[model samples]
Structure formats: C-alpha cells, structure tokens
Target: MALFGIRRLLTILLIIIRFRLDQLIDVTRLPSWLCILLRFGPWRLVPAPQHNRGARLRLALEALGPVFIKFGQQLSTRRDLLPDDVADELAKLQDQVPPFSNEQARTLIESALGKPVEELFGHFETQPLASASVAQVHAATLNNGQQVVVKVIRPDIQRTIEKDIRLLYSIARLVQHYLPDGRRLRPVEVVEDYELTILDELDLQREGANTSQLRRNFADSDLLYVPEVYWDYTRRNVLVMERIEGIPVTDVAALNAQNTDMKRLAERGVEIFFTQVFRDSFFHADMHPGNIFVSRKHPERPQYIAIDCAIIGSLSDSDQYYLARNLLAIFQRNYREVAELHIECGWVPPHTRVREFESAIRSVCEPVFEKPLAEISFGQLLVYLFSTARRFEMEVQPSLVLLQKTLLNIEGLGRQLYPELNLWDTAKPFLEHWLRDRYSPQSMFKRVSHRLPGWLEQLPNLPEQLLEGPRRPIEMPVPNTDIEHLERQLQQEKRSYRWRVLGIVLIGASLMQAELAHWSPHTLALGALGLLVLALK
Candidate 1:
C-alpha cells in the first residue's frame, strides 16, 4: 500500500478505537474466538465514551473527515433505510461541517472562476452562510447589484475522498469474503453509488445544468420553486446562483408565527412529491430539511424554494409501471397481485413461490394498515415492504435508491409540518390519475403519432431490404397444429372486425340521412359510400 493509504488506515483505526465504535456491534452472537478477542484482548484497552451510540458514531465519522461526513449526510435523508436514532444524529451533518478558512475559499473560487472575488462580486461575506461536506456557501452580490450565493469546493478534499473510497473498497471485499450474507448487503455497490453522487457534486457545471433543468420543470409551478443558476459565473469548483429569501423548513415556530396553513403545506408537500415522481419522473433527490425552504410571501398558499440540485432521480418506463402497480396493490391489500407483479417484473427470482411471497407481504403490510391513514407512517410502510422483498432475494433497483431517499425526506418534512396529514389519501388520487393517463387511448395515440414520422422514414427501404435477403429453399408442407390454430384465430378476428365496422357504418349512414333528409341524393349516397369504406380499415 502507498504511504498515505497506510497512514490513512491507521488514522481511521485510531478514530474507531478512540470512539469505541466496536461497542455498537452486538458481539453476543459472534463466533467464540472473535468474541473472546474483543472481550479480553488489547481491543478492550481503550475506554468507550459515555455517550449515546448514535452520537458516538456521528462524531466518529466527523472525525474521519469530509468523505465520511458526506456519507452520514446521505444516510440522514434515508430514514426509511436506517434506524431513527442514527438517522436523527446524522441529520446534523447536513449543514454542520466546519468550514474551511475564508481566504482558502476565496482563493479556490478565484482559481476556479478565473477572476478575483472583488471584481466578480460587489460585496462578499467572509463568513460562510452554510458549510457542507463538499462545499460551503457565502452571501454575495454581483456587479449588477443582484443578490446571490457563491459556493466554493474545499481544496484538496478530493484526494482525501479518493483515498477513503479505496479503503472502503478493501473493506467491502473483506466482508464479501468472510460474511455469508455480505453479498446481499451489497456494500461495495452502495459505496460505488455514493462515490458517483459525491463526485458529481464536485462539478459545479453539472450542478448548474441540474438546477437549470429543475427550474424549467417547475417554471410555471406554484407548489415548488427552483433557484436560477448563473451559468456565466459557474465553473467546475465554484457555483453562483440567485439567492432566495424564505424560512427554513425546520423552523416550526417561525412558520406558525407566519400563520402558514400547516395542513395545506403538508398536503402540498406530498402532492409535489407524487408530481415529481410520477408526472415528471424527475426529482430533486437531495431534499433534506437543510436544502429546503418555504417562501414567506403567501401564508395561505405556501411555496417551497429548493436549493442544492446536485442529485436527481428518474425512472424507466417499466420501473414506473411496476412501481405504480406495486403501490396500488399494497394500497388495495392485494398481496397475491403484489407477489405476482414482483415476479412478473423480474424483481425476484422467477422460481419464487407466489404463495410464500404473498404471505410474507401480507404479514408486513397488514399491521401498517391497522393504523389510520393519517397516523400511519409512509416511510415505515415502504421500509417494511422493501424489507419483505429482501427475504425473497429480490435484487434492489439501484436507480430507485435516490427516489426512496427523497421519499423518506419528504415524508419526514411533511409529518413535521402537520402531524395530521394523510399522505396516503393526498397521494392516492394523483397516482390513480397518472396511471389512467398512462394507459389511456389518447396517450397511445400520442405515442403512435410521435413514432409515425420515424416509421415513415424507414418505410421506403423496408420492402427492398426484405427482398434483398437470400430466398429460402422450397420445402414440403408439414402439418403444424400451432400454425393452423393461429391462422384460424387471425381469420376469425379479421372477420369479426370487418362485420363490426360494417355495422357501425350502416348505423352512421342512417343517422346522417335522418339529419339531412332533404339533402341531395348524391351527397347522401357519397356519405354512405364513405361510411362503407371504413370497413376496409
């Protein structure tokens, strides 16, 4: 190993020992040899801190530095996938990371943007408004006198992250080799996903593009607002964007003082979530409390102003359909359909028994349904459903992880806004409408119309291409029951449709003559003839 890697490993080991993180693990069920070592060997020499397990874990990660701090920040949003205590503690990491010096921030910004801070901004605050694992933000004004926020990436943090990621990969391989269920946990894959997300966040231009796309998605929306990205001032390591004035989503007292309609706000939060997930299929994935704010202009009709658009989620068509069906099935308490849908969608092994999976789903969902929709927890229910799938060895959909995290965050924020909010009822109607529109005839017609031009472009060469292929040798006729049956079925369907169209034309002809009995015979005859032509279709 390289010297830095070896030193970094030592530092991590020291932090782990100093914080006594091993105490967080339950060693009672471990193998005898390991248990004895942990209990009696030098490992026990270090005294554990007298703090809550969650607090100690958080402090340990913070001590490890920014890369681990970013992991904790991400974990904080995924309350559904984590224990409440740990997630609650990790939530502090979202905006609580200690900031780098202002001089360093200014130097990094100047180097990245190719301009001095003074020339670019009329005034810049030396103290950071917010400090995150990857970057910190400062209040600033453009030369045009417009208020904005300047975000600067930490200098030399990327090297630390890369080194830590290598260490994580090594640990993942060790776990996969030594632990029986380590593959199921997919620790390596999870860390890789985090690596990509955090690395993407380092690119301010990418974030600028994400911000612009989100702003366009909700350009006319009142429920949510996205800040405009100042592209001219954005670069790989520095970002400038329009500053928003609003109350932080976490400040319950301030919102109450503003006379905000808490119920409407909470319900709107759910609506916005469904709209993003179903209607647009694109969502702001990093929606922690720190990244969200509520506009104070309208107390009666609250609007959300979101910042930090580094992570986004989108669903494929198959995923969208299956996920919707699964949610609807869960809502309806149709465990059998849920199980069948999982198999049909290839979420679980094809050979998995439907009855077994159905029973498991029933057990997981039944208790959740016992509570009133207003009192039930969306995150908990989803977590239970996902947990049930794990028993069937269902492969997790990597892309939807972001959506799941965002849902957990939204659920948390909604419940905080209004305890009585019925997320189920608020979101059910929207989902039903989206599904209806997805399968409607008008929707089909729109899709067909979109592809018709492409089909037309390919039409002229299709006949030539088919004829260019080598002709098959003549063969003796063979009796095939399957082909005969299929031919008969197609003929029957064609005859039926032909008669059906004829009947419809005859009825239309009679109505037309009745409406214009005094019209010319030739015009009426032509109309009847045109109606008859529909049978050919």
Candidate 2:
C-alpha cells in the first residue's frame, strides 16, 4: 500500500503540474519555506496557466479518477467559496462518467438477478441512458409494460475505490504528520468519511432503499418527486426504478418557456431542503443541477423531480434541535443565545468564555446585517458564519458537514434559479413552524409513543433479574458446578434492572401511602413494571 500510495501521489503531482495547478495557489499566503518548495517542486518545468483554471482543475481531477472527481463535484456547488470561472468549469464535471461495456452490464445484471436481461425486461437498451463513477443506468421496460431504468454497478469498482481510498489516507496522514494545522483540518477522519460514503454508493440496493424511504417521506406532497423502487427486480449490485421525464433544473430557458413561477419554484427548492433536513433529517445530500429536474405538471406552482439517492445526510435529534435554534437566533440577531447554544451543544470548547464568543459572533453577524443587500448576500452570510466558527476554536462536527455542504449547494442553486429569491424569508417560516410543531403536546406524545416499545422490550428480562436478585449463598440450596456457572453468568447480567425496579416499588409505595392522586403515566409505567417483576419473582 505504501509503494502504491507513493506512486499514485507522484502521478497526481505530475497531473497537477501538467495542468499548471501550482499557478492556482497563492503561494504568498503560505509560509516562506513552503513557498520556496513550491517554486523548486519537481514539476516546475510545466508551462504557466493560460486561462480557464477551473477547467484545468476539473480535467486534472477526472484524470486522477473517481475519488478526485467526487471532490470536484463538491467544489462545483460552492460558487461562493470559489472563483466564478472555476466553479462554472467544475460544475460541468458530468455525473455521467464514461460507460462500461453493455455486455459487461448485462452479465452483472444476469448474475445478480439469476436470469438473462431479456427474461426480466421486455427490452433492455444496449447503451446506458446515464453512467456515473459507481454505476450506469439503462432504460428498460418491464414485462408488465412499466418504464424503468436498470442501474448496474460498475465492473470491479470495489478494488479501485479501495485503492484510491488507501491513497487518500496516506496523503491525509502525510499532511497531518508534517503540517502544524493538520490536526485542525482532520484529514484522516475526512478521508474515512469519504471512503464510507463512496463505498455505500456501490451498494445499488441501498440506494434503492433510500429512494423508497424518500418517496415515503413525501408520499402526500408534490413539491419533490422521488422515483418508485421496483423491489422485485432489485439487488445489491443492480437496482430497477421508475424512469422520470422532466426539464433539467439548470435549463433556465426550458423552464421559462414552460412559464414556471420562478420565485415560487426557487422558494419551493428551499422548502424542500429544510423539510428534508429538519423535518425528516434524511436529506438527499447530492442536489446538484444534474440530479434535479423541474416537473412540468405544475408550472404555476412548480414541483421538483429528484434522482440519485446514493449519498444521503441525516442529523441526530439533538443536532436537529440545536441547528434549528442556531439558525433562528442568527435570523433574530441573538448573538448571546447563539453562543450559549454552541456551548450547550459542545460545538465549541467548553472552557471557552461565552462572553468573548458572543462578542465575536456579534462582530461577524452585525457587519452582514449592516450591508443591506438581501438574497444574494445570504450565501455570503454563510461564508462569514463558517469563517467565524473556525475562528472560535469550534471543533467542526463531522456529522453536520454533509448538512453544511448541502445547504450551501441549495443556496447557490436557489440564487441561480431566481436572483430575487429571499432565502431567509423562505427558510425562517419553515424553521419556526417546525420548531413549534416539535414541541406541541401532540408531538411530545408521539415522541413518547415512538420510544415506548424499546423500554417495553427491556421489561421481560426484568422478571428474571428480580427472581435471582436475592440469591445469596447463605440462603441458597447447595449448588452443583452447573448451577454455580449459571449463577456467575446471572450475576454479570443483573446489575441495574433489579435494583431500579426495587427502588421504583419503594417510591410507588410511598406515593400511594401519601395519597398522591395525580401519578403521571410515566410514574404508572414504572409502578407497573415493578409489579410485574415482583409478581414473576
């Protein structure tokens, strides 16, 4: 792996020089010694960059292979973070990677399905409708005359992905070991996450399940359309799903011809994003223009058609709550609450002074508010917010990084679709509504209802614990070695449930004696569980 990594790194460096990427870096921003190294690097012989730096960068990444191409795909979304020319060039990095042999695709599909393609589908196209790094999709019609696409995994891609991932780890390690800011950057963990995400995409069936889940999430809504997964025809290596026909989201001219309400369409996009992130917490992490299209049925109130569910992002309950609160506070200009939320969520160092952090936040946010320009500046506001986060010694949470990337992508997308789109206006109402719904009495009841089964599952074993709770050697009948072995095993497992039940019984006794009339359902549950344990014993 080391030798392979070294060779691969050297080759990447060669490609970088071929594209004259060294010219892209502002060496003046680097330390003096690093600047010296750049001037004296092995590829200094390459000609200087002429123009189209973004194109050159994209070309280099494509040459490097799928892993690098994925990086380019992410960079393409953050137009606010990169030069406009470069972002435009990288945005052209097609998700449709060059296709593999149709013959190979058929063979894999046959192997996965235990039948020839002809037996399953009425017709399978020899050529793929689309190809991507991990898989390709061919247009097909089922025997029942349903139009669908057959998604087949790229041939022998696991080894290639593993090899590239190893190279990434090696590179991350080198940076972490050699640079002062390496730990702060967390290269190894980032590469690890990338590795997991890319590998998960290799499972076609998993993507199918994601599609099904998203479809269910918005079953009653028309804002976003998710293709239906044909489970009978799906496998881990091959997935079959309904095909969709819609105008590409990026085709502004096509949409305008359709008389789509641009402002409503743009706002709907924001609504979909927040709905997925905060409401469901299961968002399509990849929402680039290529994977999204505009449905034609509702031109007056535009709906979206989304595909490619290979990469999904989710947040924990705590993250979802804090993130909502943080965004709300940001809109309200409540710097102190924002700072307290950060500390409460442990996003920043606990030892950090709240007063100083609040002041720093006020400094960053107040400037943006003072600037006055509306929607176009929302993206700029995020850039400032992230910059402030980095400065306050806040440890960037890996779990939320996908959410961060996705929101930025959505921001860039909304701004492009409708320049007059007020992102905050669309988002604030949704956030407020979600927060209100989250704490409503009905919602709290639903939350308890969802978790009740788990607590109930632990109760059956509580009886066994209670029966054995008083098995003192002095009180027990003489035991054989088998019984002794059983006793030992039982001792290991019976630590908490028995004593907790006993404590609950004592509390219930006191409450009943005191004639407390309003014992809550929660208290009743504890008393009932204790009674069952004691009865069983």
TM-score of each: 0.84, 0.80
Task: Tell me the alpha-carbon RMSD of every candidate.
Answer: 6.8, 8.2
Candidate 1 lDDT over residue span 458-512, tens digit each: 5566555434432334366646766677567666666555554444444344444
Residue 236's lDDT within candidate 1 is 90
Supply the global lDDT for candidate 1: 0.80
Off by over 4 Å in 2: 1-7, 22-42, 52-56, 75-92, 179-184, 376-380, 453-537
What's the lDDT for residue 141 in model 2? 99
How many backbone collisions does model 1 have? 0
Candidate 1 regions with alpha-carbon error over 4 angstroms: 26-36, 76-95, 179-181, 465-537
Q: What root-mean-square deviation over C-alphas does model 1 reach?
A: 6.8
